[model samples]
Every structure is written in C-alpha cells, then in structure tokens.
Target: MDFEEKPFLRECKDIIEGSFGAYLNLSQQIGDLVNQHAQMVREAVSKLYSLLILTGNHSKPDTGIFMQLLKPLSESIMAIQEFREKNRASSWFNHLSAISESIGALGWVTVSPTPAPFVKEMTDAATFYTNKVLVAYKEKDKTHIDWAKAWLQFLNDLQKYIRVHHTTGLTWNSRGTPATASAGAPSAGGPPPPPPPPPADLFADPMKSGPGGDDTRSALLKELNRGTEITKGLKKITADQQTHKNPALRSSGPAPYKAPSSTSQPVVKSVAPPKPPRFELEGKKWMIEYQSGKRDLTVSDTDMSQSVNIYKCKDCLVVIKGKVNSITVDSCTKLSLVFDDIVSVVEFVNCQNIQAQSMGAVPTVNIEKTDVVEVYLNAKSLTAEIVTAKSSSVNVSVPSANGDFVEHPIPEQFKSIFNGSVFKTEPADKAA
Candidate 1:
C-alpha cells in the first residue's frame, strides 16, 4: 500500500507548484494593469488642467466652488504620481491598488460631464482617496499617502494658477469694501483734460542734450542715490532669540496685595517677563555702540580705545597700525569682523586677501573704501538687511550704500538662532 502511494504524492506536489506559478503570473498582470491606470489618470488630469485654463478666461457661474475642488484634485493627483514613482510595486498593494482604481474610475465618469457635476465628483473622490492614503502613510507604509499628497498639491496649484489668471477688477480696501467711489455720491462734472502731444521721436532718449546740455549722468546718479536710501530702511532680521532681557528700561514688579476685608477674588499671576527695551541682533562687522549725542555711530576696529590696523605696502602684507580682530567666515563667502569694542575707525587699503570676524557690540557695520565683491550688510538695531556690490549695474542696498533712514529692529527668531546657547555649543556627540 505504501509503495503504491509514492507516485500519487509526487503528482500532488507537481499540481501545487503549477498553481503557484499561475498565481504569480496573474499577480504580475494585475500590477501592470494598476500602473497603466495610474499613468492614464495623470494624463487625464493634465488635460483637465489645460481645459480649465482655456475656459477660465470667461467667468464661470460658480467660480469659487470650481477653484476649490480643482486645487485639491490636482494636488491629490500629483501626490499619487509621485508615490507611484517612488514605490516600485505600489499597484500590487491590495488596499492601495483598489483606492487607485476607484480614483481612476472617477476620471472616466467625469470625462463628458458638465463642469459642476464633474467638479463635485472629483472633489468627493479626491477627498475620500486622500484620507485613505493618509491613514496608510501614518502607519509608516507611506505608499498611498505620498501619492495622495502629491496629487493634492498638483490639483491645488492648478486651480490656484487658473484663479489668479482669471481674477479681475479693482481689489477691496482694508475695510473689505470696494475701492471705487460710492455710486450714490454726487458727480463732479468737468471738462476732460487735454491729452499730451507725442514727442518728435518715439525712440529718442528723454535725457538727450537740450538747451541745458545733458545733465543726464548727474540726474541718473541722483535717482540711484534716492533708491538706495529707500532700501536702507529694509533691515534683515537677526538670528538672536533674546529681545527682552534689558534690565535698564523694564518696569518694577507688582507689589504684594493684601485682600480687602470684603470678599474679593484672588488676582491672577502673570508668567511673562516685564517689559524691556527691544534690542536687535547686530551683524558680525557692526554692533550697536552706545547712543551718542542723538544718532547711533558705529565703533570700528581702528577707532577702539586700542587701535589695530592692517595694511599692504609694496606687495608686503602688514598690520601697519593696530591689533588683529576676530575673523569669522562661511563657505558662502560671508565674513564678519570683530575688533576692540572701543575702536572707532578702521581702514583696509590696497589689500585683497582678508579674513573676517565679529565685533563685540558695535551695532552697525562700518565699511570703508575697498573693492569688496559680494558682502551681506546688516545693522542689528536698524531695520535693514543689505547686500553690498562693487561692480556696475550691481545693486548694493546697504545703509550707507545708499543712506536711507531705518528704525525697526530685526525679528527675534533669526536673532535667537545666531546668538543662542545651542548655536555656541562645540561640535561633539551632542551635535549628533
């Protein structure tokens, strides 16, 4: 009996192996089918986006709803495509594949429908699929969620792009009212102003030599100077975090209060610090020197109580007069200079190769005559961030580059990063 069963057992084994082989082949086919559907969906979305742009020239009856749905739909589609590219076999994932199929089916359903219905269906499917995918992503199997997010961003950008192009007419004022004059107001009937005559030559330069000989160069320089002054007011916020630690200007703490004989509610305790003077983060080269006569003057390395100056003579580099200050530089070619807190004046002459550092607390970056290429100029107390340039047509909008008045302090977040304890820590395992 045992000998007779051997052949049957071998036959059974062959049957099982053949079944698994067939199953593997079918699984692969299903995966390919899913990928094909995803690709088709992406194409459909791109076409829809284009159609929207073309049609959006005229105001839609329901423009707000259309844009709202369109934006999210494109975003979801982009997220889907991105996920597909990153995940080699996303289509084979049982749950994910089903969601992708449903989404793709929705595209087909909306193909010939009117904008209103199509938008409704797209919005529903996009939201549903996006949620499903997000859940999967949170579980650390981000295959579905990644695709959904990409698709969502795509849809959003498409809608936003269309909305921006089609929007027109005067914008509302701060009070949320139309900016045009009130319709009920009385009209001021007057003759229209005469139109100005065209010049003899349309292409002729306005600054061409006239009775007053060409003063174009001087006028242009003056205009350029005016623009520089305006930019000086735009300050770059620093990396310092502490903006409220000044003790000099802070108000005194509240005195202990005794409860009246009559029943009274207890006063709430305040957890925040007392009001202090707002101090901005100064850049490396310049620091806020003490408030002088009325205006703030920057203290320089050479002007310190102890002066240190570096000079180059006949090809020989020399520290001609003063002591060397701190030099700090980054790979980006940004450098900072730090000198004796007391120095009032420093000069660089006929020298190119230089290291940089940060001065202790001088407040403003004072730059003397030198052919420096690219430098970022920042004054801590003043509200301005500037890039200095030397070449022609290069715009350098620092404080003195085109002296403009600035009063606002740099933002605290940026200042904190630059002056924080964490930033000062030495590289170690702690960095890890």
Candidate 2:
C-alpha cells in the first residue's frame, strides 16, 4: 500500500509542474507580443513625423508610404486589444490601454491630409498617454519607458519644424523662368501670345462679360464665391473632427482615443466631493469657515479678479478687492464681508452677523432671509433689494445732480423684521 501511494503522489506532482510550466510559457509569449507592439508604435510615430515634415514643406505625401507604415500600427493596436480582452483581470490592463491610445493618436495624425497645424497637439496628447503608462508600471519596463521618452523627443522636434516652416496660402511649385527667356529675350516683332482664357466658373454671370473684352472683375467675383464655399466646407470638416477627438467628452462609452485640436485649449471636467461646513481660507482653497476660533481672510485684488465663483462661507473676516462678476453667499453665520474696490453683483441669503463695505462700484445687492445686516458703500449708484432682515444698517454716499456728494439714510420700511435706522447716506466727496 505504501508503494502505491508514493506512485500516485509522483503522478500528481508531475501534473502540477506541467501546468505551471505551460502558464509560464504563455506569459513569456504575451511579454514578447507587448514588446513587439511597442516597437511597432515607435516606428509608426517616427514615420508619421517624417511625413508631417514633408507635408509642411509643400510636398504631397505618398499614399504607398502611408499604407506601408499604417499596416504595422493597426496590427499592434489590434493585438493589444485582443490581449487586454483575454486577460481582463491583469494589472497591466491600464498601462496597455494607455499605450494603445497613444499609438492611435499618432495613427490619426499620420493619415490626416492637413496635419501640420495639429503636430503640436498630437504630440502633447501622445506624451500625456505615454506618461500615464510609465506611471502605471513605475520602475518596471525600462525598455518601453526609454522608447516612449525618445518618441516624445522626436515629436517635440517635429513640432518645432512645423511651427517654423508653416505656410499660409496654397503652395505653388517653383516655375523656372521659361527656357526661352534664359536663351534670349523675345523677338521684338513677334506678337505676344494671347492671354490665357479665363478659368471656367459654374457660377459665372455670362451677361456681365462682353465678347472680346477682358472680364477680370467677373472672374475675381467668381473666384471669391468659390473660395467662400471652400472655407465653409473646411470649417464643417474641422467641427466634425473635433467631435471625435476627445473620448472623455463623448456621452457614449469609451471609444478609440484621438488627439485634441492644436488650435483649441483642452477642457477640464471637475467633480468635487461634498465637504462639512467650516471656515478656513488658505492658499487656493475655496470654501472658508471657522474651525475653532476667529479667522481673517484678506483677498487681494488679483485674487478677486480671478475667482469665477464664490460659494457659502462663514465665521470669518473677509476683505474683498478688485472686481468679480458675481458672488453668492448663503446660510453663513457670524460673517464679516468687506469690499475694498469691488465691482460685482452680490447676493446674500439666510446669513447672520454680516458686515459689508464697498469702495468701488456699488454692485447690485440682493438680500433674502437674513439678520443683522450692515453695509457701507461709496458709489455712484446704490441699488439694493432686501426680502427680509431682522435688523439692517446701511450707509450710502452718492453724487448729487451737481456732482457733489450727498448722504441719505435708508427708509425704515425697507427693513421688514425690525429696524431703527436701516440706511445712512453721506456725500461722496466727504466720504472720500
């Protein structure tokens, strides 16, 4: 019985070893395929950059050359996809995806008829994707990392070439002076050849041109119309291509990646997580709230000018400067708002213990469901609408009809909750 058990255990050991060996072989094959794919992508990017230079120099790209280069690129992209599908759970999936995207962007640029203007854009996009791949693998995969870096350098060189030699109008072949001119001047007695017939135009006005007479004006008009139509068609094509450029922008599921337009800036989408109410302002943080004790927020003119949106904040002293388009504060408690040189529309709702001052333009102020509101504005015009405030105090200085400053107190009826003096008006000159 002991001998029989020993034989069975040997057989089981052999089976397990064989299975492990097979898995190792498969992994080796996959690794080889990945390297091959990366090599193909590198080659494609190189060829594409060469072709772009040719195009920028006014030389037409050869279709045969493009087809030859594209074949390997397409193969690599496909192989990457198949591998990713087969090993969906592998940690390398993200890196592989990023590599594929970079290659796809290069491929798109390669086939584009007018890619010179987009060279920088495509190169930047490729760099972005390749960096993502490097980050995913970290210190692993040194070969591919080096390859990607080299490719990026090549792209940078190509971008510089395109920018320096870009041509604006239609490219014309150099017409060496006619052989006759080099040989000798035309014979004085020989009649000059008749001017070439005007080019045909589908929209030409026949009645406008008389026989045996030059119709230069009519021809110019026809050319202008044709140029306009061509421009419109080109614009439509550009718009359509932009729609497919960024996969992140598409409402549908992820698709093959393409480079963003070189002429346009990239759009960033932000999704911020909800935060607990607090008043803290430091550096670039938006939400301001007091955590333990009193705090001060001194916003410079440059900071105010750059802020596009201001949200809820409380329990701190806020000094605003410069101009903001609009500002909205809601549900804040024990807040002090000071305006140094603000030019903005401001709204406050359900806020308590508020103080506001305006030294520049008196922005349109809208208040609702607030208590203990105070404002001091030295402005040309003061416009404010308050829905409800328990206690409100206001001092405004406005220029009189004679350009002199005058102070006026806000009407008692303006404060609905309870108010002794809601507004105080002073002469603008005296306030200054």
Candidate 3:
C-alpha cells in the first residue's frame, strides 16, 4: 500500500511533460514545412511521442525506441533543404532539437539493465546527430541562424531542466526485472564470498575421522603451537625478504643478454593506437592532434579568416591568439581554449571536463556528447548563441558590469504543465 510515486517515476513523467507532448509541444510548423521527407519526419515524431505517452513517462523510456526514432528524424532533418527552401530551416532545426531533448531526457534514467552501455549508446547517438547537423549549417543567412538559435535554446532548456530536478536522482525502470536472472547464482557485482576456511586439518573431525581421536587432538594442538611460533617470529622469517627473497625470485634487469631458447615463446609486438591524432592545416581548418599536458600551447598569428580544429588533447591549455573563422574541439579531455572571437561557430564534440572562453563576438556554439563544460563569454561575446545537446554539467560565465564574471546557468530546474493551447515552460534559475 506504500505508494510514493516509485523511484524515478516522477522524473519520467517530467520528461514526458517537459518534452514534445503534454508538457511541451513539437511545434506543428516544424519539419513538415519542408516538402521533402516531411511526412516521414512527422510520422517519426508522432511515433516517438506516442511511445513516450504510452510507456516512457510512467517509467524509464526505451533507448532503442528513441534511437529508432532518431535515425529517421535525423535523416529527414538533414535533408530539409535539399530541394532549396530556407523557410524550412526553422522546422528542420526545430524537429531535430526536439529529438535531442527526447534523447537527453532518456539519458537521465536507467533505461536498460546495462546502464553504462545504455548511456554510452545514447550519448553516441546524441553526438552523431548533433554533429551531423552541421550538414545544414548556413552561416551567412540571418533567418537560418535565428532558427538555429531557437533550436539551441530549446536544447539548453532541456539540459537545465534535468539538472535542476534530477541532480542526485535517476529515473528507474518500473518494468519488471527479467525472469531470466539466475536466482541461485550470486548476483553480478555482488560482494565476494567470505575468505576460505583455515586449511583442511583445521576442520578435521577429531572424533570421527582423520586418525584416532586422541592422535588427532594432539596433532591439532601441535599445529596450533607451530602456527603461534611462526606468527611470533614473522619479522625473523621475513628478515631477508629484501636482501635474498626478492633477489632470488625476481629479476631487476635483463638476464645477462642470454639468447632466447627454442622453448621460449616469440615476443608479441604491441599494436599502435587506431586513428592516431592529427595536427595540420587542411585548406582553412587548423588541425591539432593528441597534444597532451602542455600549458603554453598557442595557435599564434591567426586571424578571423582561419579555422582551427583541436582533437583528442588531454590536460592541455591551447591559446588561439588570433581571431579565427571557427574552432572545433573534439574527443578531448581536460582541454582548455582561450581564444579571440570567431566569425562562425565554435564546436565541441564527445569531449569531457573541458572549457572554452571567447574573447570576442562569435555567432554560434555547438556542443554534443560532452559533459562538465564551462564556457566563459566576455562582454563583446555576450550575444553568442550556444547550442548544446545531451551534455551535462554545463555553465556559462559572462562579465558583470562591475568587471567580475557572473555565471548564468541555463535549463534551471522548473516545471510547466502543457496547456492545451500551447506550453509555456520557464526555468527557475535563468532570471538570475
């Protein structure tokens, strides 16, 4: 009779509400506006929403369902303008952004038995679609850019919603646990069995077996005495451990350059990493690869005409001193970027524990699959439109009038019931 809205059930409801149906609207004007694959897009959206309404919100949503929906939706969105109509940009962007929200919502819960792979696969999808959206990028057109901003705003809101509400909570799968689980076997990842009993003789039944009763008892006593003596002389017994025990058993260096005998197995060579990092200028893009643990690295003498791409760098600080056309940081860890403004977008993908600061105005910023990102926007770049999808622990700091930085977090925890006419969702912390 204990009904407290079982674990993560509310989160599921919020996700459903906050997403494209009850709590939010998949804007009717979107996707379908484009003549190409519009019906497919709508059908995919309808199917996804219907699935969410039916079972997703009552518990953890299915990752596979969302992914299946994502593929068609992504293909449709990417193809919105293939026949040429800028008006469709808004709808295309809107539909994709909506899917991003759904995907992000799905990630905040345990949808499958394997939580790690579930999150990872979902994250991969997020990154794939989000980055692939670049195929639709048209920087010179203001209207197209505006729609892009709208999409970014929606995505940012979804992220903020998750943070405010589910910081320490995860949506649980209310679905019944699999009956296939072996009840008799120790559950996976459970604690190890207790240490084995003391040797066989310690458990010998003196009266029933293992020699006559008197003899067994006497032998047990003698064994215990020997153990006690050994315990007391532990330091004496181990005294030569450093001088003889280790030297006798272990080799400190190669053994006298002896040739390998026929009995010895041939040494297997170590394999190199697949897809090693790259740093080169291909046309307009400056490629930086696998640079690690450097504090004073610089992309010097660059101007607003050049493009910079950083990949897989770790624990490093990269300073782009010159104004650049665009910058992209991908699959990197703990990387920092302090750079002048770009004429186009700044993008980050599949990265973690990373940050970037814009010293000048930038038109757009896109982030995907990355978590724990900190963005610093100075006064000149305050108007930058940031688009992040399926990312976590993200914050933007802008310079306050007093010359200090004031961090403004998007997607603050808040709630808005979907009204019949339209949904009006407001973030709780965004006003500050």
The numbered model that scores best in lDDT is 3
- lDDT (Cα, 0-100) at 318 in candidate 2: 70
lDDT of 3 at 384: 87
lDDT of each: 0.33, 0.45, 0.54
Q: Order the candidates by lDDT, highest first — what do you get?
A: 3, 2, 1
Question: In candidate 2, what residue range of length 10 has the lowest lDDT sum?
Answer: 178-187
lDDT of 3 by residue, 1-432 (tens): 112243333443344344323212323333244223334333433333333232322343333332332333334333332322333123243335434433433333323333334434444453443443443346443443434344344345444544553454433336633111111212123212122222322112334542245566678888788865757755554655554556764476445667779999889999987666565666656778788787877888676767787877999999987778777787899999998878778889899998899887877788877899999998888888888777877889988889998886656366776889888776665654
Question: Candidate 2: misplaced stretches above 4 Å?
Answer: 1-285, 289-292, 301-314, 341-343, 380-432
User: Model 3, which residues run further than 4 Å from truth?
Assistant: 1-271, 274-277, 412-416, 428-432
User: How many clashes does each candidate structure show, in the order listed?
Assistant: 62, 14, 3
Candidate 1 achieves a global lDDT of 0.33
lDDT of 1 by residue, 1-432 (tens): 321133332332232234322323333344564445454454434333332322222233222222323333444444554555454223233234333434442232123323234334454445543553453346665544445555554444333332333223211123222211111111122111112212232112344453233355667777788976857777675544223554432345444477696667778888985333221223323222112122222233342223232212122211212332321111111122334332222323222433222223223232222334222234432332222212111122234546663332211122223455465433232211
True lDDT of residue 339, candidate 2: 61
Winner on TM-score between 2 and 3 is 3
Candidate 1 TM-score over all chains jointly: 0.20
Candidate 1, superposed: residue stretches over 4 Å from native = 1-34, 49-121, 166-432
